[model samples]
Target chain A: MPTIIFNRPDNRSERVDASAGDSVMQVATTHGVDEIVAECGGNAMCATCHVYVDEGWIARLAPMSEEEDELLHGVAAERLPNSRLSCQIKITPELDGLVVRLPDRQI
Target chain B: MSASGFTPSAGVPHMDIDPFSIEFFEDPHPAHEVLREAGPVVWFDKWKVYGVARHAEVHAVLNDPLTFCSSRGVGLSDFAKEKAWRPQSIILEADPPEHARTRAVLSRVLSPTVMKQLRGSFVAAAESRVEALLAKGSFDAIADLAEAYPLSVFPDALGLKPEGRENLLPYASLVFNSFGPPNQLRQDAIERSAPHQAYVAEQCQRENLAPGGFGDCIHARADAGDITAAEAPLLVRSLLSAGLDTTVNGIGAAVYCLARFPDQWARLRSDPTLARNAFEEAVRFESPVQTFFRTTTRDVEISGSRIGEGEKILMFLAAANRDPRRWDRPDEYDVTRKTSGHVGYGSGIHMCVGQLVARLEGEAVLSALAKRVSAIEITGPATRRFNNTLRGLESLPVSIKAA
Candidate 1:
């Protein structure tokens, strides 16, 4: 199975196995990754499942859409250039070992 | 609307009991278990509508909003066939694709981010309320903490003029009860809340709300062309309509659960982070917003029983939460239980739009009390306030022991 790494604000990290077809949000929620509150169930209706993609993997992932861009502005944390809604990032085999930082608080 | 021409299949169980009766509301558990065991679809002869009590059926029905539409109204009175008592809720009574647009703007406006911003004020209010209750020594949880906490904070969050803050519960009573059969409960609530409806309508206007509050954020969406300006105020109405009494009842239910189940209280006391989950469990256990109606867009079959087109199916969310088929210990009040799939918040796209708000409010209050108070002892009876659609207490006299 492909895997992803979730780094928390406190400098701790969890490397978890991810299913090939699942979104990063799905993996985060399934593994009970803390503060990954996909409140609107990943409709992009809520921007709670925000993550800061590790720089090296940013270009390797799918580009953000207009909806994701607009929702990013509404996130509680300071939105960075690498900020992405995890629900919009679908996991692919090539994206294994992808790293994303969880926001300190989602709500 | 009456299901006069329609009929249910012989496979569906028939019930003669009134689900709206005060007697049923007072002790609904036995009836709920019977409804769940009866069949997937049970026809309540009193209302002449089908009832879906099992978790699977309720989940499936709510998920397939396309087939079981809300456009006809989410109440016994069908909007398609008869005039509604109020302008049908643009959000609650609406279905996609329009429902999608309105829901998007709403979910955006009241997202977790907004709750983050409101967290400071909400927690402060919760802490202050706890202090007041402690000073009083003994008080009704309903009047003092449950109702008082939300009433103090939510109106300020909405930025409504403080004078008519009292109108929220009456208006909410009218909105929720209107979903049921227009019996004495519905009629009485409607009569008493007429002026209150007018009062709330005025508050929904953009000019009446303070800038940078929940109403303002929604209206900002209108300016950006996400939703119509006309739809903005009504959407704000949606928040007030669903947000108030449901939350008040939710808090009351949590306090009642902790008081009755000492072990659970101890569990919550040991770890304050479980406060949110405790509130969620209480909501699952109590099922505050008891039921909703979904008019069938087409003939539907669930588990083997058939329900016809234009028929009303009362989705018993409370009953579904307790269905033994769903939870490991459906009757037990355990704060640590995983309550993710519970229908207490409803299900599918129309799931409670205000859930994030409810969670924030529930957590703030629960965390505050769990930290300051050691025991929540029931000193007097916890009286059930009967409404056609809501399950809550009118009074819960309790004295707390300081930690």
Candidate 2:
């Protein structure tokens, strides 16, 4: 099991266990986190499931899908170097102990 | 062409594939290819409708309400006395000033600030649901999570007790299905949900809505003479019907896409920030709400196809999302596509008022999952739940081994 830590803007954090083969969005939606939307049902069409990966972890993940990259174009919040869609991210052994920071708000 | 040259069945010449139907919804690329070849708009006589498979025309109709009036209803049924049950969505159906007023009330009541204020409660409820689903390890993403989440959140926020909430799904499903022809699908939904519409309506009454929620707020606006009392319940009804399924379908669609692209799913886990973009990309790719109809308010020329006044014009959003002309490798699900201009939430005045809320719900769920799950993939065959207008999945079975 990968240990996923959610750091909110207020600096509060919740640590949860992410099972292998589970996409980040599914775990969050099923577990009840407040910050991610996973709208478009995790299809990368709504841009609501955005989160900031810990800067250090960016390269460890696979490259962003063409579809996920395109949908990020007009999000209201500023896009950072570590921006990603939770649904696009799937937990793997390599990503075990990964830490993702949540934006203060999704809307 | 030999059978191998094209799809095994349906010898329709030059037909790529039909992704909207169940047989093809899972993998619609072949059908999209055929529609793209046919032209910007192809009249599918079998479905008795024209498909605007190209991106440009689909976007045009989605954005231009004047040419593509929504008053006739966005479904296949004429919404005539024989088939119609509920009234049209004034906010979704009217033009300009009328639409402007109803939308304004909904906006004032369901504003970003208001939704944000409810974040704590929404998050708490979502967490409980997530915990239950996560415990199961393998479950149906649609019924177990997506549909269950919004049905739990919105009604409570609207002040409905748990008992009053039972009708939400059936009512919304029927309302959206009624947009199609009065076929078995429509008939089944009607018969199933018919008994609940009255109860649903009763809950929307001014006296019934719990104070402090959005429903009460609308009633307050009516009292202030900002809007007619007659309009309050209808607007609330609109919120109930449109708000729930849209988010449900949206969430469901994203899950389906992620399952199809393991690389993309892995990318999302590496950096949860991409979750928002991932959702938008899914909508652009699958278009949960596939098509919205409009009656030509007057004579109109759409991409050189003359549409007479009062003629029904169906806008094919799913086709447009995959249109090759407007996108590079359009069929591929790339999160980086410039999807801001996409018409997934529609355009013009009738754009979804509760979009912020929907986005918030999506972000909360995905972000939480990113922090917990290590790997997620489909464990069983995914099934699509068909509705005339809602393009969404019925089941997405995934296997997870917690990290």
Candidate 3:
């Protein structure tokens, strides 16, 4: 099983066994990792599931679409080049050891 | 409409009119067309808010919260200035840092996986309800089916007791009503719900919520300090505020469309898969949550209107949904219409969290109806419910022929 780690400011950490085809958001949500919202249910309409992909992992994830980019503008946290809507990024076999940080807010 | 006369600081489109009056509320399409045609940005004078009526502009405003902040609050009355009768919601009101934590907890608990697990139960409930109504032949769609379905499943899923759940509609109505002008509609709902606020708050306590439900998960997050315990029920209120009336309105609208357009109903009956699309198209035709307010964070220009920082902006979602510029033959109800990107469930960060639940409930009810009812025809005039934000029917008498 692939593993993904979540970084929270309070030093809270969660490790989820990412299902082969699950997005990081899906894996986090299914396993009770309470650090992601994904309020739009992975529709790429809401930025509630926003996360900052580490530089190394960014190259592995698919590029963002117009909808995802548009939604990112609404998120509360500071948007960075590495920031991506987790719903838009699916976990593949290639992303075996991914690490992502949760934003302070999804709004 | 001189380009030089347009000030970037006053992005006020020319057609800032009151949308809540009887004439506009009864039929806002003509005014909406004027607003859209006048400019992309329109100001609502009575509410003292600027707004976007054009489809593309509405989507743009909804998608850009940084420029249009929700941190102040969604309602017309600023909670920060007023002593809000109830606690504020972490997910609904707060900006990023605070908003993120609550959303995380809610998302984790109400994940699609969990929803899939509950699908069978929801479908069963929907089927049984539809079957019961179909057997009756003639029934009010709002009271009988649309309101009944979510009023049953959503509250039960929250572990709200029989008595506690009674506050669902009134509480939600006031919550949404308060988002509009502070008139009789707002006052009436608030006064009715004021007494129950304490009880509503108490329900969020750990002891009140039964285990293995979304409400309990909210409390669990409260314990984790992701959200305050006080905020739990209020967040739960967001579910209630958003869940019941919207879904009820949505289902009512869909059923109304089916009755008004028999061809669409026939298509849904033959092709059961069209049920989902049918519901969405109905939502497009009549947006349930008609409008929501957002505040401008900085000076912004849209459609030759310049809105200054901290100004209120009320985006007319229903108007935008019928934007002639965006959709051809915008008034007609056609299930086959390309209605994919409509603002029926809103857009961007503040978009509805329970939309999946709404969609699933709709599909379930429509699918069940398709199974049992060979045909449905309207027998009486459907009365529109008087709600500031919710566009729904109060009664829709329909005769259904059981298959």
Candidate 4:
């Protein structure tokens, strides 16, 4: 099983295991991790699940989708090069030790 | 096309259900249960449309927009087969590449950030409205609180002029009814709504809307080259279509639930913060926007059943909300239950853009009522407001006690 490391802005961290097919949004939500609102329920329509990927893992992640890219522009927090809608990132064998930094806000 | 090119009557469960009838609309649960039990995908010979009532299939179809397209129309009438009565909504009816731009504009405008900005005004309006209605001691919840609350805030927030704002309900009522077959209801709504439709159409323009409102925000995006100038009004129309009846019915459903289920009201009264969860559970228990039909762009298989190109697949969000396979004691309206993933607002890319604001409105009203009203009792039998697509009350006479 792949594990997702959610680094909360409050300086707390939650490392939870995720099913291979589940997205990081689903993992955070299922484990009751805070700060990932996922307001659109993993639809990529709402940017509430915005997260910054660990710089080391950015290249390994799937390219941001057009819809995700569009909504990312409107996220409440400052957009970063590593900023991604966690709902758009699916868990896979290669992403087993993924680290996603939770934004300070996800309004 | 050959019979082999399309879905053949093999393993598909055929149901004799008439989904559009008033009887079905009034109490759809039994019919929904029947649909779900029949199969994951059922073919309704009466309407000659495929139906998916189970959560998995309906969610799957909605998620895969490329295959189950909306551009053909999210209603009984196929736009490809006939001329649409009005301009197709660039956001609602357009496919991905066409839908993306306008949807991006709306998704941004109606995001949680916008909801946070709109929250204060919405709560203030809700507080004032609830207070005024509670003073009546006994009044119609639907007409007095539900419809009145949304009418007071939403249209004003949308930048609609206050005069002739009575036209909003009729205009929106017709829009919902137009989603079904061309029945007497649809025909009557068309006849009764001509003037209101004209007023609503006029309100969609950049000049007609207030300078600093959501409408202007949308047009500003157009000015910024996010979307074309011509697409702005159509996007406004999408907002009007999704925003009005949905919130009204959502609030109405929550109020009705609290009134009918005294224990649940007691629970909410004890913990006012459950107001949001209470509103959501009510939406799941009594789905406001019951059903929407999506057309298949090509031959598609869902849960072992095949539906052909251009065929209408009725995604029963209402049905899916109560599917026994997906919910525990699915019929109960428990305020404390976590009601995420319910299709009360539909799902996927086409999910209700009106949702965030609607949730805020519902939470505001319910929390205000919970804070002040000790008890809510239906003084008279609730009357149903019939729209082909909307499920809400015409009147709910209620008497409340002060906390």
Candidate lDDT (C-alpha), each: 0.88, 0.71, 0.75, 0.85
Docking class of 2: incorrect
Q: Report the number of the highest-TM-score candidate.
A: 4
Name model 3 segments beyond 4 Å from true.
A1-107, B1-11, B79-85, B223-225, B228-230
Q: Summarize candidate 3's per-residue lDDT along B1-403 as a digit string, tens digits.
A: 2112233244355454677765677877788788888777765546666667888998988888788767777766555456655566667777765666666666556654566677899989998998888768888888888888988798878777777666777767777787877777878887787655666666666677778878888877788887776767767766656777788889988988888888888888888866766887888898888888777667778766666776777788998889888788988887656454688887767677777677778888888888889988889988878877888888998888888
TM-score of 2: 0.73
Q: Name the better of 1 and 4 by DockQ.
A: 4
Judging by lDDT, tell me the better candidate of 2 and 4. 4
lDDT of 2 by residue, A1-107 (tens): 78788887789888888899988877776666767765444535456678889988999999997556755654446678798888889999888778888877665
What's the residue-level lDDT of B160 in candidate 1? 86
How many pairs of residues in model 3 come into backbone collision?
A: 6
Q: What is the lDDT of residue B364 in candidate 1?
A: 95
Writing each residue's lDDT as its tens digit, candidate 1 over A10-42 gives 989999999998889889887878568775555
Worst-scoring 10-residue span by lDDT in model 1 chain B: B1-10
Candidates 1 and 4 compared by TM-score, better number = 4
Cα misplacement distance, residue B363 of candidate 1 (Å): 0.7
> iRMS for all predictions?
3.3, 8.8, 9.0, 2.8
Candidate 1 deviant stretches above 4 angstroms: A1-107, B1-3
Superposition error at B3 for model 2 (Å): 37
TM for every model, in the order presented, reads 0.88, 0.73, 0.78, 0.91
- lDDT score for residue B264 of model 2: 78
Tens digits of per-residue lDDT for model 4 on A1-107? 88889898987988898999998888987788758777567776668788999999999987987767777777889999999998889889889889989988875
CA-based DockQ, model 3: 0.04
